[model samples]
Target: MYLTSMVFLLLGSSTSLLMALFSLYKSVGYFIEWEIISTNSNSVVMTLILDWMSLLFLGFVMLISSMVIYYSGGYMEGDSNMNRFVYLVLMFVVSMVALIISPNLISILLGWDGLGLVSYCLVIYYQNEKSGAAGMLTALSNRVGDVAILLAISLLSVYGGWNFVFYLNSICNDISMGLLSFLVVLAAMTKSAQIPFSAWLPAAMAAPTPVSALVHSSTLVTAGVYLLVRFEPAMHGSKLSQLLLLLGGTTMFMAGLGANFEYDLKKIIALSTLSQLGVMMSVLGFGLADLAFFHLLSHALFKALLFMCAGVIIHSAKDYQDIRMMGGLSKLMPLTTFYMNLANLALCGMPFMAGFYSKDLILEMAFMGSINYISFFMYVFATGLTVCYTARLVYYSITGGFNMGSLHSVNDESSLLTNPMLLLALGAVAAGAMLSWLIVPYPYVICLSGFYKMVGVICMCFSCLGGLCYYLGSFLFILNSLNYYKAVVFSGSMWFLPFLSTQNLMFQFLLNGLYLHKMGDQGWFENKGGHNLHSSLMKSSVLLEKMQDNSIKLYMMTFLFWAVVSIIIM
Candidate 1:
């Protein structure tokens, strides 16, 4: 507790200093950097871009991580390895800082790989079979992006420099460097857990709650979005950008739908993160990197708060993550429920919350952009889904009956837990307006029809209807149709993405392919091609040596063979 308080104070000071720098840099832009390696065409430099974006983002990362650390002190009390957990979280923050500060891609690797490696360690920190499986899935899936980054670095060598700042400008004219855009998008998708790479995130819920709060908030998951925000100048208008736009919208829809079906408290929150990340990605795909960054910041605040609240609930309910097992805890834990509600409503983009500023702006832009109705419907559907699931989460977790058996106890408040949650809840309430004013110097060019302008509001109302219907309908047992169970099973389980990732056809195919390669290429090739080649050569050499050791008998045999060969030839 003493250490966490100290760390929070230290991080608070750092955040204030960075905010001051954020203010100062607006008047005079500056790159605080130190060159690490020098070459004729390229010099590898450790650089920090001190524009408002980096400063604001860096400040938020420090603040949230520090608060998470503080919350963990209470959340993790009595654990033998609490010290180890704290150190791991501290390292995660260090890597996150490195990622936020880096302007050079080569230097970004240090942070990028650090996040992957440390997250793997943290994911498996629980030391159980579930944790072990989740860790491997998380690490290996991220390994694809790591390899993509290394390939990107190699591809970057063609320009004789690894500084993305230098090359990003040339991206528009130098058609040759288009591959870099693809590589970057791929890397970002992997890091952010988009599409096929999306499975590891919810699986990562096997980690302790503090790790989820810190990592999912502004560190591990957001790293990829931040990377895209940095690379947006280069990737905008490219095929990769188009794909991100499409993929992002789909991810948002997929995750929102999945959240409605989910029962686990943590999984629902994880799915919400996925949906929010999709919103950021889609906006960036539309070439609005600033808007995307703004959403990223806003999402970080509330989402972190949401997870912290979930942690408190999980602790109170004695780790019953299933909402089915939970009930009306609002009376028991009024304070915690209030914080949870604030976070949930904010996540729903309820007016004036942090999510409203960015999400509404994104939805407005999505409607206004030169997109097909399919894309527009995706945006609208996904937005409504967000509200519906959040409403469901609140209804199930807080407003429902107390189903945790009579003996189990529920606490309404814990200062150790609520302190950090309250701090974040404050941000979640105010950050939308605050960040919008600070980050976006200009407003979005929203040229929607007046009727369309109200669509987002109406969509939320309709989403409220959907949530009401689902919640009221769940208890009423109204949906008894044939497809109802199928819909719940499919969408509720994240399109069975978890199953697909672990034991589905794709995993089976890949697993079999790997086995075949090991058996044939590695095992069979070494035995047959390698050893057989040596044995054949050795036998030939022995026969030649015998022939060369020519005595009278050998000469006679040779002569007889030659005569026989000659006869055969004739």
Candidate 2:
């Protein structure tokens, strides 16, 4: 079943890639719409848009999906429900493809909702407490994006159709367009795991590594960036774009800082994904949607390869994900080490690698743009942080001494895993240059000063040196210090973002509920609703009882008073 799926997906990928090339060469797109219903001023249609962007992204997705499924055949060996896992991943790819082809808001929701639902299933595939929690966080965080898309659909309903493509230009500068753009941006932010929404991306590493390679690296997380890219035309020059810029920069900086202090191998990669996502969003926020899309494609290729390498290592190490326990893998598994190094260098934007094409362009463009100093600092520092973490990861996992037990044996003899990785390594090596040439017709002409041109290289070189030095030095000694201890914990923990996303958010609501229980439910509501009513009823009943008990004399006096009043009226 896995082989058949892989074959079909590979075929689909090749077809899509051919179609993408043809579409790009011709500079044409085809839009197909099947009207489900049309009445008076309302219409419902199923739409599929086959453009260079959509087809090219679909090709990359299928290519990666095929590799991941093929990898999973070995990675998930002996699992009872491997078939179910493959099905869910296939569904995930289908959803992502659906989203890629649909320009209509209504049709987009169909795909958007599927991605969220299927992701929850994939995240909890392990069926454990940690997986369950991660799945919930992943589900709930994505639901925010889902709701945002739904709202955007409702807002677009007034136009007699739900196809947002038709209205982009007409609504670009309208007063209500800002609200629409805000909804779209909000949805993208949640889907891409930007800022506060980012905690779920790392938590989602509880799933199988194959799923991590597919979902986290390419399809699922990139959905938001794709959405923003599609809507960038309408959102340019809007307040929301500027806000997205700031948030993306912050997310980039934050994730890079956190990854440096992290030791978990999968999490380090996950944080790297988050940082790249921020770079994508920041580019979009800069109104360079084409550049963002370029980075998105190139990033998907290499990042997926990186995850697969991590999977092979983890499997060899008996599923231990901590880098501290891993060492000297280059001697034991030279091929996997080579592949890992290739992906790592590409991720760091080493010259002529897949990442260098898009990533270098992004940094250079940022320097040329009229961005604020904070954003400039983030771009520079985050680029450095990428190198720092990659260096740290390579040092601990590839070059450091073997820290595991002597009795353990690790090998890369499994062709099932290595073959897929070999395919992706090609992409990690060549996809960037291929994509940059294909997608970008004319090269960007930038006239930046020599100092600015060299800024990125200088920062990366220093960061790499710093990372190696820090790891070689007494890390324990530095960590044991009171001042550095707090800083390390803060940075390592992703600035307590997981706490803010789950515990802090949950606690805040719980604390508010406690206050409400004290002040409203138990205090004021009790006083005004049940307790006050009970007391008033009790007082009235007691007074009535006293009146009745005393009272033949009281009744006679009341009757005499009424008689006197009647006589006076007469």
Candidate 3:
């Protein structure tokens, strides 16, 4: 089975390379349309768009999914439902492909809903309470995006077709049609897990690590960014775009702050994904969709590797996901630690790494462009927080004292797992340089004062201070538990977001509505209306049966009485 999966990986990788080459040399964009229905007012069609952007994203998705599938062979080997897992992953890839190729809302929803459904299945694959709760949160959160898309579809009816690509040039001329962009941005927010929808991204860490790799890397979360990328032209220069910019910046800051306080290995990584997603989204909202796309690709390479490394550690530690229980594994699992360190370095936007080329560009753009204090602060603080938490995490889980008891051996025993990490590590190391050349050969002009230009560097250095402080501060009882307990615990638990998503927020209200529907709706309505109607029909049937007596004597007496009465009246 692993051998078969290896073949699949090669095919996917080869196909992606070919597509990338074709995208550069020979590909000319085209749209294939199949008319589903047509009316005077509006038309629905299945539109497949093959363009440079779509092809690029499709290739990336295939490449990342291929690696994740190969990696899963070792990780999920002992599970009873391994086949189910594999099938779900394959469906996930197909849905992502569908989403990338879709040129219209009608076709997009097919892929979008497929993603939501398949992701829920994957999240709940373990069938535990945590997985169940995570799956529900994941599903409901994405449903908000789905509904947003539906609203956008309705608003887009004025254009007479679902294909926004066809109308991008003309859309700017109409302010009334601008509502579509707002709906689209709202949809993007939910799909990308920005701000209020963010609780689910970390909770979804309940899934197996390979699923997280696939999702965070290229499939589920990237769908929203891809949407914005495709819709960029239409949304340009609109208030909706500016609104997204602010929201994206806020999400970036929020996630970065949260990651610094998190103790869970996977959740911290998940929060980092959220933070980077905010960067991609904010760039797009700034109307530089190309920059966002570049960051998206780079982030996928390193972030996927990050999640794979986390998987190795957790598996070796016997499912202990808390970093407090992990320490000094570098001596035991040298290879895993090497891969882990490389991925983390790339995540921090270290020089020459995958994150550096894109994230640096994003920050510089924000600095040079017409940006306000809030956005400037967000970029600087978010970048610092990213590095700070990453450094702190490395100290906790890799270099600090060995916190766990001697019960299990921790080493890189599986070649299957390490091989995938190695492959992704190569990307984490060199993809930035390679893709930077391809994606952005000539950089955007940043006319800033020398001191102002050093802002990003200053923040990075400050991040070192922040990381050390956070790590050391964790040891002090007063800081960890006493006076700052509320602040510490608040950020540590993602601002009680899990509770908000599951019990304290919209989902709880939804659950209550379901309960009301079951008890009040079905229960009372059934007895009062359905039961009464049933009794009334039964009573009428009995009365009719008694009146229709089949006895001949009763019929003759009734006839004779009627005949005598008629004669007396005459």
Candidate 1 residue lDDT tens string, 184-291:
888999999999788999999999999999896567999999998988888867788789989998899999999887899999999999999998888988999888
Report the Cα RMSD per candidate: 3.8, 6.6, 5.4
Write model 3 residue lDDT over 105-156, tens digit each, in one string: 9778889999999999999989999899889899999988899899988888
Models ranked on lDDT: 2, 3, 1
lDDT of 2 by residue, 9-45 (tens): 9999999999999998999999998878999976666
Candidate 3, residue 160: Cα displacement in angstroms equals 2.0
Instruction: Return the TM-score for candidate 1, rounded to 2 decimals.
Output: 0.88
Cα lDDT listed for each candidate: 0.84, 0.91, 0.85
Greater-TM-score candidate between 2 and 3: 2
Per-model tally of clashing residue pairs? 5, 0, 0
1 against 2, candidate with superior lDDT: 2
For model 1, what is the alpha-carbon lDDT of residue 343? 84
